[model samples]
Target: MSTESHNAENTGSNDSVVETSNLAGSGDFLIVCEHASNYIPPAYKNLGLDETVLKSHVAWDPGALAVAQALSKALDAPLVEQKLSRLIYDCNRPPEAENAMPAQSEIFTIPGNCNLSQADRDVRTKTVYFPFREALATCLDHLQARGKSPVVITVHSFTPVYKGVKRDVEIGFLHDQDDIFAKELIKTFAAETDKFVLRLNEPYGPADGVTHTLTEHALPRNLRNVMLEIRNDLISDQESQQDMATILAQAILQAEKTLGKHKNHTAPTTKPIKTGN
Candidate 1:
């Protein structure tokens, strides 16, 4: 479903409506971003935090949504994104996980999420989280039904400083017990002319048991997929975002050539799927 109007507060002139939109493409790829916004609707009232806390990483990944938007336009792929704060309901995490509704994200207390009962959690999950995920699944299904099983690429951005230490790796790939797509993409990216010093999984890895939407949908179908994490500093603005998109787009094209097409139903006879770092 196309989201026309967004009642979110003004963060900047570039801020656009944060809802799921499908930019249908003839290419064999589908892109999505689960934690796309830091916007808290008027109803929530800043999650009862001070200005500093509201602007923290707890509110959202600093620049992920921007990268996803640029990548979607560059690659002409269908894009899906969440409309609320990850602290409200982490679309990337399983609903039952303890950290799903974190009381403290890194170092900020989510005062608005102090003690949510099962019913309270259920309300947000049913209302916001499920719809966002459904939108992604629907878009993928639409393509698959048309004899095109698109490669899934989940985009995200990470903070440069997590408590004071600086994170140098500009890109990371996260995958659970599977690395068919992640490994190939990482290798392809490293060897490209761009020569991205991509991290295998520097910031975070799938073994953290942080169940992302990619794991929920793409992996089960055995579809080629990868979770990309770029350092937030690299995508804090349009110029940076576009550069990252170009770098990623090249890597994706290389993966398509090396891994082969998605049309063939047979599974690849590669090395056993291993968990990425």
Candidate 2:
């Protein structure tokens, strides 16, 4: 079942935290992992779910965070991650989106997030969503100010089979309207192996009008961006996660080549800017 909204209450959780390397310099890429962790702060007591459930996809991307960490180390890039469960408040989703405050996520029921009032939602937006996004925008601005055009790569992982259906593709690129980055990445995967079939906008899409951070923030800067989805089964272990991270790192390197080919073409910018909390 899809969770459409979440109710909130007073909690002793810090809305945002920035995890980074001490090596501070402009890196060519800036990575963003919207559902980085499944951590429900000590105060929330796992948000009324089984502690084992905390480790499940309902609370976090099963293997995506590991892939992101491997990619960050391999690429020497700064990664901006959401510290809490997406169930608490999805960093990728717009504040007003239905799933922005999910009543439930995956198989878990969010006891703290059922039948929320508008005021509760507003507090969540202020305390959780805004702060992380604001940090992202500020980081982007700082990098740009330093003359670094960071290529935004969002890493996420999906369950291998949902509702008992098997998936064939190992990786997918999620995007909307602008296919510049997605198309190039597809070509890279195609050339790499027949076993590797990259799906364009498969698994997820931005067409339904749910706001995602990449489309909202990075796209406006004319910054090259793409959302990557890896099947959870492929990266369920450390070895596999590293392997995919290497694959993605190479693909992004190839995408840089393709972007150079289309220097004359660029997506037009849009204007509804919101301050990240």
Candidate 3:
């Protein structure tokens, strides 16, 4: 289904499920923020939760959109973002995954997601998940048609403390089976920044199912890709978000230069399934 038709059907006075910015940008980087907003449509009734929970990090990545927007502007790249709350349906996850409509996130329970019927799950997938994926796919297709091999960069945020433990790592570069690009970018960040702890998959890793978007969109196409997880506390304000985005943008540019030198890098042979659902 087309994005306009899906938005008309599902979003009642709310923003579109998927929003694209700088679509005509000529840069070689394509930014994606799967949990950009925490807005739930009036139809869901806040997913049967209190108003306070809807605004918390559990509902969405607190500063991911700000960093993504900054990076899009800095790099002159197109950005595809999800506008609905993850509580409705996490755009980053496969539609059939249990966490797609999470019954609980972090320590809070999602009352609306519990005991959902199959029909309800299907509706969520059809309305929110598919449209978001289709929009991103369309963006990639557009760039590819223009002879652009855009690097996919998915931005995310992590809580300072999870499950009662404090996380010392400030930034995490996550990857799936393909780690060449991510490793290069990590080396660049390590050499350039000494202000915060940088690590490979500290807070979340491939096992956490966080790489679904990268694997689905970038892996099959052999696009240089990585998922960046910044500490929410570090980017709690506009100034910090801009600062972090600058650092990340520089690292990405450096990595691109380095990768450009290696002309024979081969992509994986396993093809992704046609449907991310």
Candidate 4:
């Protein structure tokens, strides 16, 4: 699903910059993976990074696409994903975001992103950002046109250790302005007999500008949304990815029932979920 397209006019779901699939799935949910690929298109000269850095989480969320695809299949929901390295254009970020094309990520310096003019940024906005946004919007519009309001779910993965600091949070549930969906999700994980370090807004939160996708799509449409940030080490293989997706899918489906209470837009209390054993 590595995509490469330079034309801003290529805004369709079939566009090379983004990928949209599982359209035949139900409307209960719409899943998106913004940092799905690590492809640099052989152009940017690997963003002036080494092979290892390009393959690192700084380039993309390792094993996130697998989990997202599994969720899409399990929920029978449509999924959208960006197909280029985040170093080229972070689909989850707004065009004005500084890290949208970060010159440095963690400790690795992105030489390719350094010293970019406004024109260079504009080119990437048109080529990468627009296509991903349009694709997700198209999915939402399709569901809306069918008179179906689906909960928007975004999938992502974080490095186990970041900038030399070890992260104890195994899984993080983030919300935009809405906390109804997030509350139930965290509750489900906490209620489960199995132990997992699932918490609310750890490592990165809406305050860190990581909820841009949810704000842009779900908030405007008034859809229930939550972003899942899993530890990449937990999903390094197909078996682990599927296993994690199954547990998450069960929790997500069960949590959807709580949405009924919030139809009146009643904001409930957000109780913290204990994590990090």
Candidate 5:
């Protein structure tokens, strides 16, 4: 079920948490945008930060949702996204992680998230984290019922500079220990496009704990998966987002074809692996 409309409604200052589009698409690919929106649901009062911070990359991946939506259209794939800001509760992180409700992200401190009581943490987990997980699980279950195994592609964006240091990679394909799917994508992108710098785990890696969603949801099931991180500056607008999506969509399609040819020869690991950025 696509919760595009109802999932955008947050009653009584509560967050909607999860939003999905193209939920019934038949393609054997699933697109996920964990930091899609920067919405703070009014209850947190912008997490006690200014409007600029709310719009910054610290709150959300600036253009990840647009790229994911474009990919959903391009590939006829289902897209599931978190509707609230990561400051509320990072959907990509496990609840036990310290940054799950980060007191500080990058250099800015999240005043609202500081010194949280156990009850406050639990509420955020129950309201935001659990719902997001359930939504993705439900979607995956539906696809499995149809005998369709999906290649999960997570879309994310990173700032061009981190703590005043510039990052050289324009695009990053992040993966955990199971790098088969990510490696295939990297090879395809390297061969097909030279417009931007591409690398494997550049700005962030599994050590950054950014691959929690993939590790928790896809790895155990042995689902082919990859996390694509575009430099935020590269996809700051509609045109750029569309361009990146087209480039990524082509690469993913080509990689899927390659995976198909080697399906019988290789299989993805089913064991839960250590997570990453």
Candidate 6:
């Protein structure tokens, strides 16, 4: 059964901004999808965006949640997701980051985000970001208390093209400070005969402040972690999302074997890093 935490209210309907699922999962993974929803509460006035724009990548990662749920089912892993549009407050970003509540995204300007006083931004943070953060922290603490050093796997999708430039990378494995898991995943994908167009960090990287969740929740605790960025077009449909989820779940399972519950958390000897976006 799934459990939800609600905050935003619209037209007398209870809307949840954070959700947790499969908490009693028997697997050793925690699946996170920060950009899971595009549902904007009436509070921001759609962040002053058009309907089409609100449904675009800037609002949320289209198929990321589908894939994340698939992965959770495939691996019997626990999952957590945010249900509000990232334009409100990107859960993946700390409140201090500029893009946490972006004033502009791509060529489109965010009128609601512009000229915001600290109090205005803080309201969004309190409403959306903090609850999600606490939920994740509680999940991790519970798992650790149960003697499970769960692997942190965050799923996301990047637009195939950005600013009119077509991206060549089909999958990107990103890591923050911890590189062993990402390197192993790269190796696994590289060995695949199908040969996916992959990279270490393609559309984004730690330098871009995309690793805030990883650093905030995983790094300090010394957990194996990797952020998977799939090209949105690849997983645009349910079948494709499941296919990609199957592929990722297998890779993660294999990578876990290589690490073998490394209580010491030592990096396994692996090939040289060559694959990149």
By summed lDDT, the worst window of 10 consecutive residues in model 4 runs over: 1-10
lDDT of each: 0.71, 0.71, 0.86, 0.82, 0.85, 0.85
Q: Which parts of model 1 are misplaced by more than 4 Å?
A: 1-18, 193-196, 265-277
Residue-level lDDT of model 1, residues 1-277, one tens digit each, is 2433222233233333345565456667888777777776666678788877667676777777777777677677777787677877777887787677777788677888888889878876665666666676777788788788677888887788887888877788866655677888888787775545577756777656553776777766667787888888777788888877887888888888898876653334444344444
| Per-residue lDDT of candidate 3, residues 190-221 (tens digit) | 77888999888767887778889988898878
The reply for model 3, stretches above 4 Å from the true place, is 1-8, 261-265, 269-277
Candidate 6: regions farther than 4 A off: 8-13, 192-195, 266-277
Supply every candidate's count of residue pairs whose N, Cα or C atoms clash at under 3 angstroms. 0, 9, 0, 0, 4, 1
Ten residues in sequence with the least summed lDDT for candidate 3: 268-277
Better of 2 and 5 by lDDT: 5
Tens digit of lDDT per residue, candidate 6, span 1-277? 5565756433124767788898888889999999999988876689789999998999999999999999999989889999889998899999989899999998799998999899988887887888899999988887888888888999999998899999998899998677989889878766653657888877688878888888889877888889999999999998999988888888888888887884567432343233243
lDDT of predicted model 2? 0.71
* Model 2 spans > 4 angstroms off: 1-26, 208-211, 261-265, 268-277
Roughly what TM-score does model 1 have, to 2 decimal places? 0.86
After superposition on all C-alphas, the RMSD of every candidate to the true structure, in Å, is: 4.3, 6.8, 4.2, 4.2, 2.7, 3.4
Q: Write the per-residue lDDT of candidate 4 for residues 114-211, one digit (tens) a residue.
A: 99999999989988898788888988898878777788899999999887889998999988667778888988867663567877887788768888
User: What's the distance in Å from true for residue 276, model 5?
Assistant: 11
> How much is 239 displaced in model 4, in angstroms?
0.8
By lDDT, the better pick of 4 and 5 is 5
The weakest ten consecutive residues by lDDT in model 6 span 267-276
Q: Write the per-residue lDDT of candidate 2 for residues 1-277, one digit (tens) a residue.
A: 1111112234453433334331244457778888888867666666677777777777778888889888777777777778778877888888888678788665557887788899988987887787777777876777777777777788998877765677776688866546677778878766666666568776666663433877777777877777888889889888988988887788777777767733244665545333221
Candidate 3: deviation at residue 52, Å?
A: 1.9
Q: Which predicted model would earn the best lDDT?
A: 3
